[model samples]
Each structure stands twice: as C-alpha cells, then as structure tokens.
Target: MDRQDAESAVRVLSGYPTEEEVAALIAVLAVVGQAARAAPGPEAAGARPGRIPAAAFAAGYQSPTSWQAS
Candidate 1:
C-alpha cells in the first residue's frame, strides 16, 4: 500500500498515528509483506523451493520455541 493508505489503515486499526509513526508503519508493512511472501506456503506462488530455515526467522525465538509455535 502507499504511505497514505498505510497510514489510514493504521489509524483504522489503532486509532491515530503521527507522521513519523505512519512512515515507520509503512516501512514495516513493506518489509513484513516481503518476508511473508518469501516464506514457504501454498500462497507463496513463484517462491523458491525449500523451507526457509528457522534461523531466517526473526532472531528472538529459539528453535525449540519455534517448533512449539508451529
């Protein structure tokens, strides 16, 4: 989504957002959507083969916790 649309979505979801927050939110959404599209799934049409390793996941969660989260 464009910055204005993203900001409007944030406002609809969480009330209101400052200009800086909106920009950050837009960036975050872009990155997150990129990552999600890159992840292994039926929805990941045209994605490369093989699973993305757990290490490729955000670093906070341990492998064991990730297994449990699945």
Candidate 2:
C-alpha cells in the first residue's frame, strides 16, 4: 500500500497505538513496500530458483520486541 493508504488504515484502528507502536508499524510497512516494489513481476517467472514470494516474506515476519533484540 501507499503512504496515504497506510495512514488511513492506522487512523481506523480500534484503539490508538502508542507512538512506539506506530513507529514500528511504519518501519515494517516501509520494508514491505520496498520489497514489493523491488520484486520481479510475473514476466520473470521461473527465472530464479527457490524464490520466495513477497507475501510469504511478510507473512513470516517476526517483529523485534526490544532494542537489544532489534
């Protein structure tokens, strides 16, 4: 999603997220967005071996819980 879409979704969340939570969300979104934009399209199908789809990457993501872990 684009910046505006991200902003809209955050605005609609049930409860207000803490500043740190929002920052973390934004960071995750930024990484995913960059990956999605950089990902090869269907035209490059079968060109790479063991290529993981971006969706799968996002689905398997584990956010860091503390500064030390991060």
Candidate 3:
C-alpha cells in the first residue's frame, strides 16, 4: 500500500497520530504481513495453542522476555 492508503487506514484506526508515527506503524505492519505471508501453512490443519511458526522468529519476531529486576 502507498503512503496515502497507509495514512488513511491509520487515521481510521487511531486518534490523530503524528504523520511520522503513522508511517512507522505502517512500516511495521508491512514487515509483519510479509512475514505472515511467507510462513508455511498450518501443519495438519488442527488447532494448536501457543504455537508460533519458526519462520516468524527467523523473520525477527520475538516473544516478550521475562522481566528481570535491575
């Protein structure tokens, strides 16, 4: 999607974010969408809770690490 399309979508979903913020959000969404599209289809077509595809990690997606006291 182009910048205008991304801005329009962000406007509809958000409350007046700065243009820079909208652009950043769009970039992030694009990366996530691309990763999702590249991932292989579900294995065996059965529900599996808490199972993230390995491709997502390879694409730089990370789960939240446990918080540690500094």
Residues 1-70, candidate 3: write the lDDT tens digits: 9998787677757788777777878899999999998887565455365797777779987666623432
TM-score of every candidate: 0.39, 0.41, 0.41
Worst 10 residues of 2 by lDDT: 61-70
Candidate with maximal lDDT: 3
Q: Write the per-residue lDDT of candidate 1 for residues 1-70, one digit (tens) a residue.
A: 8998776777857967778777877899999999988877853554456655555567655567678988
Which stretches of model 2 miss by more than 4 angstroms? 1-13, 43-70
Cα-based lDDT at residue 46, candidate 1: 47
lDDT per residue for candidate 2 within 1-70, as digits (tens), equals 9996676577748566667668878899999999998999665775356565676558975434544586
In candidate 1, stretches whose alpha carbon ends up further than 4 angstroms from where it belongs are: 1-14, 43-70
Off by over 4 Å in 3: 1-14, 43-70
